[model samples]
Target: PIPNSYWATPLLLACEYPWTPANPNKPKLDAVLHAGVRTFIDLTENGELRPYNGEVLATRAEFLGIDRQAIEYHRFPIHDRSLPESIEFMYSLMEVLRDNERRGRITAVHCRGGIGRTGMVIGCWLVESGRARNGEEALAIIAQKWKTVAKCNKYPHSPETGAQAEFVLHFE
Candidate 1:
């Protein structure tokens, strides 16, 4: 798990799909509810949701006591770098996060593995928020945070590709 100190707002969490069988120990809906994460930002395409242990995104959010509307799905293709449209999506995500934070709610952002696409967005946020000077620095902070979390859970997490890295650098 990511230490609270790694975040500007401790409520912002980067994660993978929690219902998959591959991660038996992953947090369940109840755990997410307890953690106060009311908003879920999904970066994967809609088509990918079916393979996630057969649980649909809207249904999972309902199970967690969250309204289906609170679960925002921004269909960013996996492995590929962000395009011009992706920047627009990032801006929109910022608005969602800001709104949620104002309401005293936490937000969780995830892709399939929650490494590449998730990390890219988080890194963009870090830089845009002035938590880091640039995308490279933002990504370095994310990598370090992932390393710390990985040491405890043994889950491999980091920005997974150079394309993602470059996208973050040019995201502004």
Candidate 2:
């Protein structure tokens, strides 16, 4: 988990959905509740969920005993490297984060692997929140944070693609 000191109040998390076959025994729901996460922003598209080979996110959350009413779930599907639409979705995501922070709720953002689209959205948030002057700066901060998380978690974590990096660098 990213340390709370990295950002202001109402922590925002970018991670992969936890109910994968490779990690069947992971106590993800318990971890989320323990971390005080009250909001989930799912960046995976419906089509990706259906034809793909993974458990449904909402079903997994429900199975983990998450209260549907207690946590807000926002689904904003962003195709890789799609500019204008991705930018629009980022605005909506920022709005949700703003609202959740106002209510003192911790927010979690997730995609399939939690590096591509997730990183993009976070970079956008950093810029939108005035923590960074531009997309490149935002990405730099994200890269630093990703390195920290990857080291702490003992996993490979970073933005997934050159296109994703470019998207962050050019995001408005």
Q: Find the 10 residues in a row with the least total lDDT in model 2.
A: 1-10
| Candidate 2 lDDT for residue 48 | 68
Q: Write the per-residue lDDT of candidate 1 for residues 1-172, one digit (tens) a residue.
A: 3332124358787876545545544455446544666666767766765444224656666776777676544444444334326567678777777777677767777776666777787888788767889988887788777765433255454566777778778766
Quantify all predictions' global Cα lDDT against the true fold: 0.63, 0.65
Off by over 4 Å in 2: 1-10, 21-26, 50-68, 80-86, 151-157
What's the CA error at residue 157 for candidate 1, in Å?
6.4
| lDDT against true structure, model 1 | 0.63
- Per model, state how many residue pairs clash: 0, 0
Q: Residue 140 deviation, candidate 2, in Å?
A: 1.1
Could you estimate the TM-score for every candidate? 0.70, 0.73
What is candidate 2's TM-score against the reference? 0.73
